[model samples]
Target: MIWILSIMMIIGIIIFLDTWRGIQTVLPLSAVEPLANDEKVSVIIAARNEEKSVEMTMLSLLNQTHSELELIVVNDRSTDATGLIINKLARRHERMVPIHIETLPSGWLGKNHALYKGYQVASGSFLLFADADIHFEKDTISKALTYMKAQTVDHVTIAPDLQAKGFWLQAFISYFLYGFSVFKRPWTANHDHSRKGGMGIGAFNLIKRDVYEQIGTHEGIKNRPDDDLKLGQVIKQNGYKQRFLSGVNQLWVEWYPSLKEAIKGLEKNTFAGFNYSLAVTVFAITTILISHFLPIFTLFSTDYAVQLLSAIFLIIFLALYGVTIVKMSSYSLWKLVVYPITTTIFLYSTIRAVALTYIKGGIEWRGTFYSLKELRGKQHQ
Candidate 1:
């Protein structure tokens, strides 16, 4: 039992190290560079039912510091005012083009299909695949463009400010991202050029147009619920210099409306992230339970011989989360401090995701039901 505890503590420390070693930006977005007119940037936004965020997001794009850019928004059969808002933005901003997605064709997820449609119309040297919910600082596009040019990478994705904050919202909004970053950063920063180990946050991704074609866009990852992960994998497999822009200062996106919405939002992604694999789901659940929360139950040692080990794990979790929180913004240190509860909520969300993906095989998002079985069936082909 003591040996098991010691090994667990060691593994936790390794996670801590990987996180620290891989991240080039603590906050994920304070870096800035200016875009030049030598190359034009085309920003494509895909909206399904983003009535709440569309207005602000459009306004932010219109206010971009760089004038050598065009914005195209694809309204993907939204049942709400999402299409109307895009039309309004097109009228308001000469640079904004409103593209209508007639319908979701078979075998394509909503966002990817919209992006592909948008991509067909964009004529810029670089392509920015941004979510409808993402609102940015006026200078965001130019800065990101300049940053990418300097990095000499084919694709650069910024870790944006994830805005949502009931205790649970604050806790897990970026947990998936944090895990993704830790897993891939070490190899990415080293320019390893390997066929594995690279990832990105999809809210704001900048890609060279040529690379986008090389990877095959939504068609390449049509069956995957987690398109962002597929994008990263494709980038690495093709030996491209995939990157992270840690300048999260002016990058902000609210993922959910309420606490319940927040929890459900993560549950959907987590379920799909595991590829509906039962073994991986069980391992993830057990690891989170025993490795992260056992200190509270004091199960490692009644005599508490492993007190040092417990403290180490907690501190690492705290430090990484604390740094990530600081990058998100200093709005509430108190919210970050309650991360233990937040982590428990996250664990719950993960469990729910697993159940929905495996048992129920149904994923509900913005009033649509996506079945894991159907998705897997497509993948096997």
Candidate 2:
């Protein structure tokens, strides 16, 4: 009983700290700049098998209110009509260019190589490495540039507004976002000058051309799954300033269509996030269960003090999750009740990611199989 209470207190403290940090750190999006900056901005998109969404993403980006812009779409060997769509769009839009990648080198991961290829030909003072599925509002780039200009940072990663349709999807995202805030502690990414903590997002990672070139770009993080995160680490390690902001109204992405897809989607990178170590995965799952899921069951305990404490902790946890939910999506506090389901599902996915990696001896993503040894090797700084 004492041990359980101790854990409960720790969990409550963490929730309080995480919520406070999020409220303090997440920046708000502003209106579109009435006047565009003269500095040329190059937007890079590395796409593969994104047939259904690539066209819309490209159109949104091309229609940005920013005047001096170059959009480079790298067709990373998509089996669908991604290449054809890029070609068609490039023909119509003078600023859009398409680069088809027919082959990938031995040491490079698909997305990393594709981004690197796009970077090679990019000619702009600033570079925006955005995802193919993300749809940017006309003012996203404008607002990003404005924010960058206002601050002394060299790189900015925006946590885009997530577009989740169904209830389960929203609930899942609520838990995911809260957990990320608690664990990732994005606020510290910029505050810590030790060059160790970094934060980045695929939705909108804008960097100056000089800073990117100095850090070796994607070449430094080749063959890694979470290239966005590693890029932040590299930038910070190189002693460059980076900022994270909220893009609720400026940018959005349809993260996953269904619950099953969401689970499967997490399988690729969840364990990889733990550096492919079974020990870390096990420890993580255990901690998650104890610190997050266990509180609910304690509410039914006959011990009055335990029940009271459990209820208090649960309320605090829901409140913390609600703060992040409001930040990430259009969901309300009502959805916070399903956080346990979200944590359970995420734990299953993490275990599945580990099992798949060990059983297949490698991880398969977008028609490419990366060996476990290779992935483990690249996990180090």
Candidate 3:
């Protein structure tokens, strides 16, 4: 028991250190200077039933510091007032151009198709594919453009400051992001070119127009459910320079309203991210449980040495989570006290994702269903 606990502690410490190192590599947008070039930038958004958030997202883009910018929003066959809201906004703001999609074509996901349509008409030197739920601060785009120019990189993605409400939701995001940092390792996205290690945040993916054209644009990743990450991977795999930035004070988005909503929200991507592999899904659930929950429970064991080691491991684990929360702009330190609850919720969600995938026989997104066979055999762009 003692040996097993010691090995777990060692593995925990190694992952903690590696995650901290990766967090440090994500440069904040505040450190970047304003753009010096007068290049034209096109901001593309794919909206489907985003009536509640589209206005704010559109207005944020309109308020950018950069003058040479165009906002192209493709309404992806919305059933609500999304198109009406966009049209009203477009009439008021010259920069906002709304394209209504009456129907979705074959051989493409809804959002990916919308993005592709927008990309075809984009006449900018730089293109930024942003989600309608994302709220950008005044200088966010300017800072991103400047950073790209300074780093001499063709592609860049900014991890948004996630706004997760309630205790369970906050903790879930913290654990989820910690795992993302450990596995995706956003730090190595630019530094290591030998491996395809780039990360693309759904909130923002800014790329050079020519680079997008070179990589075959959205057509390359048209069928991929995890388009943002896949696009970044394609960029890295193609020998292009790409960087991931921290969007602490610059870009923001409300990830989910509650813990239940998050669990359902991530169900599709969780299984899809693992390429619909049952083995990988099981491995992920096991990994989350052993890494997070095991140490805390082991602290209450009879052996004094085991308890002491468990306590040490738990503290290190909290520290690792703390770094992740701070980097993600999650200021609720009190949530750490109830870390065990969040850990349990995260584990449950992982299992739920797997079960949901099996029960539904496929992934359902935006009223579209994709089978397990289709997801497993998904071709990379």
Candidate 4:
């Protein structure tokens, strides 16, 4: 009992410190001034069945205050009307370059291959890799470029404002963000000396064109489903300058529309995040279960000291939740009351990800199957 409490206390303190550093260090995009520069920027978006939101995303980029920007939208063999929409938009706007890929290349994920193709045709001093569904404010690009030049960073990744519609979906997202911020320590990426911390968002990964090519580009992380994160890892490992920002109002994306979709969406990355190691996955589940779930049961213990300690640990946990929701999201702090339930849902999603991947022998992403053997082979590459 004492050992359990001790470990819980340690985890609680670590989370507190990590959450504090993240909230304190991650600056909002609005805080930066919009830069007026003549440097050409290429915005690359890989679309696979993104017909619904791709037009909106393209229009937002077209309306950016940054005049020296080109839009390269890749239609990654979408079975839907995504390609038609891209072609229509491209016809209407000369700055929009549309690429249609009929088939994914051998040994490459669809999106990654699409992005590499976009890069090949990109004639810009800077490249911004963004998702097809992301919407940007008029000044978002200009402000991002300003911050990059101001910080002298070669890579910049901004965390967008996640637009989850329902209560449970919002709660899950809130918990997911909290866990990611606490464990990943994204703020550490801003520290020039820290090789252990870095970040990249699929919605917004802005990097100098030379640096992107220098790191081997998407070809380096071709098979990774978590390509955005691995991109950041490779950048930091190579000792490049990187920065992270809070794009809360400046950029927005509907990560997943519902709880069911969110769970299904995470299936691609959650197991890969643990390197597909069942042992690592199990250890993470056990640790989270003990640190988060056990406290509730401990609160009913006969020993008053044990109950008090459990209560304190839970308080720290809730405080972390509150801070994460209030700072990283626009959700009300009152949502922290459901942290326990959301934590359970997160655990279920992680477990389901591992189970489904193993049961199917691989993951099916964007209508493609990547075998576990190939995925593990490309784990650290």
> Whose lDDT is greatest here?
4
List ranges where model 1 is wrong by over 4 Å. 25-28, 174-190, 299-304, 327-337, 378-381
Give one digit per residue, the lDDT tens place, for model 2 in 1-381: 756766777768776875687567777765435356888999999999999999999999989988899999999999999999999999999999899999999878899999999999999999999999998888789888887887768998888888788888878887888877877776655564567677888888999999999988898888788889778878888889998888887888989998888888876677767767788778878888887867778889998888888887777777777777776666777887777777888777778878888898888888999888887774435
TM-score of each: 0.90, 0.95, 0.95, 0.98
lDDT of 1 by residue, 196-254 (tens): 65665677778899998987877877756677766876777778887665545677877
User: Best candidate per TM-score, number?
Assistant: 4
The candidates, ranked best first by lDDT, are 4, 3, 2, 1
Candidate 2 ranges with C-alpha deviation above 4 Å: 31-35, 192-194
In candidate 4, what are the lDDT values of residues 12-131, reduced to their tens digit? 888797778767888899888886988899999999999899999999999999999999999999999999999998999999999999987778989999999999999999999999
Candidate 2 lDDT (Cα, whole model)?
A: 0.83
Clashing pairs in 1: 28-246, 28-247, 28-248, 29-246, 29-247, 29-248, 30-247, 30-248, 31-247
Instruction: Give the TM-score comparing model 3 with the true structure, all chains together.
Output: 0.95
Q: Which 10 consecutive positions of candidate 3 have the poorest summed lDDT? A: 372-381
Indicate whether candidate 1 or candidate 3 has the larger TM-score: 3
What does candidate 3 score in Cα RMSD to the true structure?
Answer: 1.7
The TM-score that candidate 4 achieves is 0.98
lDDT of 3 by residue, 1-381 (tens): 788779878998898888877778888887787855688999999999999899999999999998999999999989999999999999998888789998777667889999999998888999999999999998888888988888899999999988877767777788787777776777777675465577787799999999999988888777778899888888888888889888888888998888778888988787767767789878877777786777778889998998999998888888987888788675676667877777677677777877887888877888888776666664664
Assess candidate 1 and give its lDDT.
0.71
Candidates in order have lDDT scores of 0.71, 0.83, 0.84, 0.90
Q: Residue 87, candidate 3: how far off, in angstroms?
A: 1.3
